[model samples]
Target: MTIHTGHPFADPDPDPARRLRGRVVGAVTLWTAGDRADRTGLTVTSLMVALGPEPRVLALLDPDSDLLAGVRETGRAVVQVLTWGDRQLAEAFAGTAPAPGGPFRQAEFVATSYGPRLATTTTYADVSLVGEREVGWSVEVEATLDAIIVGDDADRPLLHRRGRFHTI
Candidate 1:
């Protein structure tokens, strides 16, 4: 059977009017230091690339989101790049069925200067929140990278695309 996907067009940044349109893809992680030293996190369906290696990461959070308060109070955050096997961990932190009960006992993790973060799946980086700006439905945060956790087997990455995870 022939599938009909609409016409494909060239992606171009023509002018101011045609600009500002953004595409959504992937499951970039949202993490913060919770009330305790435990890490509080969520899987944001919508994540964006604020800019490149002055290395700023931006996320939009609901005004009353649990993590919104976490970021505001802590002024620091961590972003973990997930692998496919990490779907469960992401779901847990995102408050899915088996929510994070206490300090993420089920998964492997390590204690950091700011908080505890996942030790499984892949890499993580600690970032310091520099500022925030209101943007319609959510707030845009600017953060700087401070520390990085790398593992020997972290070369392969799991990516979320069109609502599923695949090896990359």
Candidate 2:
């Protein structure tokens, strides 16, 4: 066995689609669902909001993620926008960092009708599942925005790009 350091994807032939996706900067958000004992969350970056008489949220989630399973069972979810300080929490949920006692133990979360929401996140939305379909290697979930809480725009949002976190 050999120990290799540096970037994991050192392959010469990289997928152009994946490279393009890595270039798209997006806000780091956490989507949570289910009850306290069985709650699950995932760090998501591929998401968008559509405004209209009935606003909506669209997110690309891992098809086999526990968060998606929870959402499917409960039909509700909480989407919380993370701040610059929440990078570690994001990593925990993303399964990229060591979370000693599960990801939820990494920070404080408050119980909501939809699910557990990050206590420090002032910007969040409670959504109900509308529909979902297989899109590429992900499950594209469409949800109706049932309620929204906007935070101060002055707060620096945690952004993800090129496999790294950024602040803006």
Candidate 3:
């Protein structure tokens, strides 16, 4: 059927899967280390693009969460793009992967062009806080671009789809 411009809801959706096939949102792995450095950091799926390229990224954090408090105090955070190999790190932050108390030996971290880079090896952009906005139940933070740490030789990106990490 031909779709008319003036008519509402006239266009037929052809191959809806195409729209969602590769659609990926920011699953910025938040690394929060402070007083309880050993038990810090968390994986949050509430990240979003704030539009434009003014070095601005908006991350939504629960105002009542400990991670949120750390971000507020430090005014900084490292945003790492996840890779398939980094699933353990992501899960640990998500509170599903267990940490064996003391020192937390599951993952190792190294320094890079960005801040402290995680050894699970994901591309990342270290950002510094620029500003914040509070809307009801969430705290949105705007951060400035600091540095970038490229991952290993692999190119596949870890994707968050339907509450789990898939590949794209």
As for candidate 2, its clashing pairs are none
**Cα misplacement distance, residue 42 of candidate 3 (Å):** 1.5
Best by lDDT: 2
Q: How much does candidate 3 score in TM-score?
A: 0.67
Q: Residue 143: error of model 2 in Å?
A: 0.2
Question: How accurate locally is residue 15 in candidate 3, as Cα lDDT from 0 to 100?
Answer: 51
Best by TM-score: 2
RMSD of 3: 9.7
Off by over 4 Å in 3: 1-28, 33-39, 49-53, 102-104, 111-116, 151-153
User: Residues 56-84, candidate 1, lDDT per residue (tens digit)?
Assistant: 66666666666767777777766777766
Task: Give the TM-scores of the predictions, in the order they appear.
Answer: 0.68, 0.94, 0.67
Give lDDT tens digits, candidate 2, residues 14-107. 8999999999999999999988889999999999999999999999999999999999999999999999999999999999999999999999
* Candidate 1 lDDT score at position 162: 45
Worst 10 residues of 2 by lDDT: 2-11
